[model samples]
Target: MKARKKISRRKHEVSTSNLIRHEVIGLRVTVVHSLNDKFIGISGTLIDESRNMFKLKCKDNVIRVIPKEVCIFKFELPDGDSVKVDGRMLNGRAEERIKMKRRKVVWPLIVEKQLKKARFQPEICEVLMFDP
Candidate 1:
């Protein structure tokens, strides 16, 4: 029988959970969309960022400021994972983004489970059993 080639995995796994929360100061990114005609298709290193805008050092050493609200960005992670993120989702500072609350919907099933656990007391169970 022929020997099979063993596939080796990397020793360290890259975590993508912190991608949105970590500082993106030096990451190379492309502007997938922009409201301003000048920055619509710019690709450059993120030299600086603020709560409202990002400054990209484009080719020819030209610095362009683009509003965070009017653009979509695409960047690659260290592990070669390409991510496309909306500008609105990245509106806040990197440090503040970690504290931002994500919008979640409370499912009926989860609410039902919580209600069942809350009503598991003996006294509540007796009342529930005798209730007309």
Candidate 2:
């Protein structure tokens, strides 16, 4: 009998790089900008999501549905890091988004970040060079 190697699973963490593939329900969200003036500056907990809209629990227990394409969302992570995302990039169902190929839109930014980190901290370069 052969001993099987156990696969280690990394817990999914949301970042600007993986915006479309992560679960976003229950995160604190804010509408930093919107095509409609009414939706600007609305902050709330995300209760639900659809292909084209988001349902949020706003102040005083009010629920509002805002179109995804018309607004820019700022999502606060559990670690207190905030990332702003454009709606156009996230235009698909959760399942579809996960299976879809990742766009290279953020690749340059990620390379820039790794380069900056490598410049400031030489030790990190060894780890980054081996990363896919």
Candidate 3:
């Protein structure tokens, strides 16, 4: 009898924080928040980007230039996680973002707070009932 060998698939890791440093052209993005009323709800594919602006190809095939300082962007990571980033945080050419100094933001604490306020409210209430 011949022994069968199992094939293992290699996992590809994607860094959520590095999205702004890489080529974002052709990626689908939504304007989650915008200081400009016209751009507040725009959703489109990013066709081009510069240090201060992004050219988005809308459904009507019209390209719109959005100022980076005035908007927040939402996009999906290759690993299926969705992230929202302030446009100001991503200011700079794609290449420059790699060399830029990133701010130290604690995410776990924020996520924990949100989790405690959601879905597990009953358990949280029980724990609170027995508080010191």
Candidate 4:
């Protein structure tokens, strides 16, 4: 009888880039801002087709743009009616929200509150790469 060889299991580590670029489908983006012209309280849905720039469907208009290059961005929501979002164009659907401010509160509770409120959509908005 031939002796059987012991099989070893090797663990492969997942890279950070792979983790960050995880795939997401059917995700939508919500943007609140003011346009240079007569557009105030400009709200729109962002479309991710590229990294440099994305398209926004305003109330009754469609505009393609590179958000990072824009100087000023403003929002008028209830909690913090005024927010300056550092906009960036990205590809695919985002699976997490990049919080601008890090709080000491529990993440789970905060996440629950976020889910309860529709102020921010879950699993949307991604980091746009400038040189990708």
**For each predicted model, how many residue pairs clash, with residues at least 3 apart or on different chains?**
0, 0, 0, 0
Q: lDDT tens digits, residues 1-132, model 3?
A: 999897643222334555655567777888876545688789888899899999999999999999876567887666677667767666778787756556433335654565455443332121101001
- Name the candidate that leads on TM-score: 2
Model 2, which residues run further than 4 Å from truth? Answer: 1-11, 103-132
CA lDDT of each prediction against the hidden true structure:
0.64, 0.70, 0.66, 0.35
* Alpha-carbon runs more than 4 Å astray in model 4: 1-42, 72-83, 88-132
- Residues 30-61, candidate 4: write the lDDT tens digits: 44332222332444554443443445566576
Cα displacement (Å) at residue 63, model 1: 1.3
Q: Which runs in model 3 stand beyond 4 Å of their true positions? A: 1-14, 103-132
The top-ranked prediction according to lDDT is 2
- Per-residue lDDT value at 126 in model 3: 17
Q: Per-residue lDDT for 28 in model 3?
A: 81
Question: What tens digits encode model 1's per-residue C-alpha lDDT throughout 16-113?
Answer: 45456566778777887554557668988889988889899988799988887656687666777756665666777867865655622233565457
Please give the RMSD of candidate 4 to the true structure: 14.6
Clashes of 4: 0
> Which order, best to worst by lDDT?
2, 3, 1, 4
* Residue 10 accuracy (lDDT) in model 2: 44
Candidate 2 local lDDT, 1-132, one digit each (tens): 999997744447765555567788899998876656799899899998889889999977999998876567888888787777766556667777677765433334654565465454343112111111
Candidate 4 structure lDDT: 0.35
Q: Residue 37's C-alpha lDDT in candidate 3?
A: 61
